[model samples]
Target: MAVSDECKIKFRELKAKRSYRFIVFKIDQQQIVVETLGGPNQSYDDFTSSLPSNECRYAVYDFEFITAENCQKSKIFFIAWSPEISKVRMKMVYASSKDSFKRELDGIQFELQATDPSEMSLDIVKGRAI
Candidate 1:
């Protein structure tokens, strides 16, 4: 599937920030890769300061891509943090097909995992209930 303009814009914003992580899911392989993108998250000041270089300070993010031809888009959800803030903020973004934004939106919703104190989380994409 092609990456929508909206998705490109988000990537540009992330690129400009110069720090973020991406969790890209490859459908063929049925796996995801959580890696650093153009830059590191700019929030880890403590660790950043202690690092050998400035690149050490940045936000860590994970992205999941839905690449089934049957599915034209994917829902992206992750935690965003910054030194200016006290708590981690969870955000949701969507990558929709140019002609099927509505369909994609209908298939997506968020599931918050606040009940688990050990690992509070948010999932924007819930393809299956299981």
Candidate 2:
């Protein structure tokens, strides 16, 4: 349940500098580590596609869209992706460690926990954004 120092630094870069579109994290031998990073120019589809189909992962997405008032807006979403098809042990680890891991990253506007693709749909994300 250890959070890497790099995770905090990378998250800070993303939130303060808009340096990344998304970040995918995985637990490597019990320590959470960065798995992949999507550049600032990457699309939401790219972020969604980066997630594995049957694995547990934590991610942060810098979401941008136009508000109903025709103003540009952004939100930082913290996501916990735990597919039902993934291993029970993996799910337990992620669920148990989520709060502690999240506490290390500040300025997260929203949080979403998805057990499958549909649960973490684009529409659901937008709903939270609003």
TM-score of every candidate relative to the true structure: 0.22, 0.97
RMSD of each: 14.4, 0.8
The local lDDT score (0 to 100) that residue 43 gets in candidate 1 is 29
Candidate 2 lDDT (Cα, 0 to 1): 0.94
| Highest TM-score against the true fold, candidate | 2
lDDT of 1: 0.28
Q: How far does residue 90 in candidate 1 sit from its true spot (Å)?
A: 17
Model 2 alpha-carbon drift over 4 Å, by segment: none
Candidate 1 lDDT by residue in tens digits, 1-130: 3334443444445434423433221111221222234334432233223322211111223233455555443332332222222222211122222123223222223322221222322222233212
| Residue range 1-130, candidate 2, lDDT tens digits | 8888889999999999999999999999889999999999999889989999999999999999999899998999999999989999999999999999999999999999998888888999999898
Residue 70, model 1: Cα distance from true site in angstroms: 2.9
On lDDT, the leading prediction is 2
- Residue 68, model 1: lDDT of 50
| C-alpha RMSD of candidate 2 | 0.8
Record all residue pairs in model 2 with backbone atoms less than 3 Å apart, i.e. clashing: none
TM-score of structure candidate 2: 0.97
Q: What's model 2's lDDT at 66? A: 98
